[model samples]
Target: MRLDPPPTTPESEHRRRIGAVQEAMKREGFKLLIAYADCWRTANVRYFTDFRPVDGVHTIAQAVIALPAESDPTLFTGDGCLDYAASETAFDVAELEHLPLYLRRHLNADGRVALAGEEQIPVGLHRTIAEAIAPAPLVASNLLAKIKAVKSPWELEQLRHAAVLTDLGMEAVQQAVSTAGQVTERQLARAADVAMINAGADTPAYLSMVQAGPRSAFSLALPTNRVLERGDLVLTDIGARYGNYVADGGRGFVYGPPSGQAREIIDAAADAVEAGLAAARPGISAADLNGAIQAVLIERGYAEFSGEARGRGTGHGTGMDPEEELPWIGPTDHTVIEQGSVFTLKATINHPQVGGLRTERIVHLGATGLELLDTFPMRNFW
Candidate 1:
């Protein structure tokens, strides 16, 4: 089910992640874990063994994790799936049913068994794991989140790759504006997509937001077939994923020139992003962070925020999954901002007539300085 990976590539990161798992197992007395996902987002599966499941599907590259208290971990996945991935990365993979009997035999003889990440845990599979590793604590420590929130050096490098791709994607939009006579919003998005994919990225990161004209003035917009005019404002937010980790980047653009409400909202949104970033130190609370930017947003002559959600929670947890775990850029986060937490602050301002202004920045809470995941811009692209 598994094969030794090449000397470079994925193996080194896999080994480092697994070594962390072994230490956690010893400290916590966790015997084994069963991590299953279509995506390689499951840190346990990736850490315990180098078996990234078929991304975006559950049955493809799935894994059944087995680890004794202090032993090198093992993984059971689809035949040839692990081997194929291992050719690119390093991991210890095997083929075995995740039945109760098989798990009991593979797990530690006598110790506690803990679930690594229960949020992503499947309902039916929880029963399977419970039946197999019974009589132990079966703890829900969210250990994976704790381990992954902090960035490793290699992960930081890969994040830069994702960011660089996003930068290239933004450039595509600029190119379209400079040369094109007329193009649909969807077409503009496609151009950016093509550029990002061709820029050493596995995919186009994600759909570049190309809401044009009046349609560009809101949150949660789906792309449509509206074409650009000589003086159309467009919002293009795009991102890329490297090694299953996401680095989201976005920007606002004007095919001609921005004025009136469009100009005000764009400036306000960029300032708000800056305010939020300024307040995101290790000791500051998420509430304080929101307050810093919320004050700026209110000062910019926009309507006051009036929702329980707390300012769109611009920052979210980042890792293999779409959301790593939590985004506490509001008052909800009681957890102290740790020294190494990776969070994406997507602060933006929106106006009814003008388009939305947004910026995506990945920040690592460091002792003295924060390492940016990407440094594109919140300015007008064209």
Candidate 2:
């Protein structure tokens, strides 16, 4: 059965987010905060204005939210997005080309300004904006990201809806792979995409990934035409996006009975994910959480395939973006896990003989403990 869409973030919540960012800017001596967003990285602008750009080949959708410490925020986009932005967001709308004029009105030469999403801002645009606010000393800041790290009640509901959609997609993949015979990886991936869209997702959070046999050894490989065979290990990573929030999850499967090595690797990854979840209470450092998961892998004699050895973290925060920066669960990251944060706990292993196996789930750190957002069977042998 299809799930209904979650409650949309009200205009008040958007205002509150803007206020929070303004407060942070005031503390940091930033007189104006300019947040840039493109089609890909939209959290910063969307957080303030709730307007997500619709990108296209001719229209490289981009948006900017200019928030002055003392004044209301303005949302700027191309003429193509003007109507949509006006309808979706409760902010003053302007043409993107007029950004310099708007900035000149709100910014003073001696005041300090900060730019969010600095890394993704185009060089030409950045130079133009810098010149527009000349002598204002626009500097890079992570204020928006830090503030958005913790999910609000409204955002959490969106994420939970997304998680349910993602679970349905993964379940579709599991069912497709379990069919009698000759199912190709591409077919399985299609099954998942169709299931999620039919179930009311804005879109699959990312390309549905289905890798079987030797192809599964590549962590981020796209689906191919390789047909599944008996004794071959299969891995599928899929997610669903709803209400601008997203859920990322994955599962492993064996076409036939699993080999002893395959079983061991999958079990180790599952155990590591469980350990990570168990240790995900508030007040614990992300490093501690990663250590808990890594410890399980090491004890299972799969240290070489652990995230540390592979240079990938055990897990990451998830929300508007599929992968948020804060609470990066890794060996050296020391960010403390806070209540109300949501994350994707994942453990992946690759073996030359058996292939790659990954177990992932979306979770939220509630007041009590980590709450599993996605609920699907972890072990599958078809």
Candidate 3:
């Protein structure tokens, strides 16, 4: 399938992001390497050469950009490169490009090299690369993962754009909840999802969640066509992906007349999320944030959480390619909050007798403290 039109990445900024990885590899002992990436299928290689593949809605897995220790990086992709890569990508590459041939042409055989990507790399390609390199076991190390986990200035800006789009999508969801006689669970899901896509999000991150009334009672939530009615509560867990970055959040809304009890649960969840965000900073551990929030829920006497919510951390890092990363912003997590990390703050409290209430937002670690990246309000939709 033909992907979306390419995005023009600033040449210098692209180089700088990769340069950080190059420097880190030098510190370790690998003389050469490849930063492999597939935006599902279209290999949007972002590196010194400035190629970021923008695939419209394809599920990418094997695509990757290989960067040698000292060479201009190139993309290795399937036949789609002829259509998408040549016209849209920042740097064009050979189609159905064999990694070994590309390596022989680009990298020296005798030098020590480190491989990229997760353990899921195709075994056939893995064997081929192993045979060519000298008999050194290029252990599975996540050099690129570590380097890219921290967002660059340009990356953060893209994330900001994504957050804005997602916020608007949530607003649409609020409107849908307010005007409908009774929202079918699936339709509510589509409303928020369509809102994101219409607002320039490349796609909704996933089938956004819509759990209604008792349906919201489950920790593992799914969207169904159940008609919501009065005294029914609705919770939507939603996110939008743009420019390869994403913004995810959740909010609850009342369908019919509100009950005093339902309002209390929504307020509690929102306050818990706020309490957690307030605790997030450079010095605090992930567990600290989780503890702060859970303390509120536990005090309110709703200790039970959706899917063992206490076990769920507030959130983790997000950036190009890698979906989630370090600083699991919840209790018992030791990941330290650091400058440059962007995380989502979410708290969903589930009650089997009633329903569930949740509030989520995006937050970044600032030089001074935690800065809220999301603007969506915490209250259940009006």
Question: Best by lDDT, which number?
Answer: 2
lDDT of candidate 1 over 174-259, digit per residue (tens): 88778888778887788778877776666654555778777766654767888777556676678765555566666776667667
Error of 2 at 175 (Å): 1.4
- lDDT: which is higher, 2 or 3? 2
Candidate 2 residues lying further than 4 Å off, grouped into runs, are 57-59, 308-311
lDDT tens digits, residue span 1-382, model 2:
7878656678888888888988999999999998888888788787876678886632338888899998789998888889889988876998888999988988878989889988888888899899999988989997887888899988898999899999899888877776636789999999988998899898988888999999887777899989898888888889998878889998988888889988887788888889888888979988888888888888888777555435467888899888877768888888788788898888887776778778998999988888899999888777
Q: Which pairs clash in the backbone of model 1?
A: 11-90, 38-57, 53-61, 54-61, 205-240
The candidate 3 region of ten consecutive residues with least summed lDDT is 41-50
Write down the TM-score for model 3: 0.84
Q: lDDT of candidate 1 vs native?
A: 0.64
- Which model, 2 or 3, shows the larger TM-score? 2
Cα lDDT tens digits, model 3, 1-382, are 1224325667677778667777877788776675455554221244334335445433223455666666556666566544555554455466534667766665555566777664546676667767656454455666765565567777788777777777878888778877886678898889888888877888876668888889988765779889887777777888877765777777787776778878888888888887887777777877877788777777776766543255666566665532454656656667666687887777777777788866878877877887777788787645
Clashes of 1: 5
> Which candidate model has the greater lDDT, 1 or 3?
3
Q: How well does each candidate superpose onto the true structure, as a TM-score?
A: 0.83, 0.95, 0.84
Candidate 1 Cα deviation (angstroms), residue 380? 0.6
Error of 2 at 168 (Å): 0.7
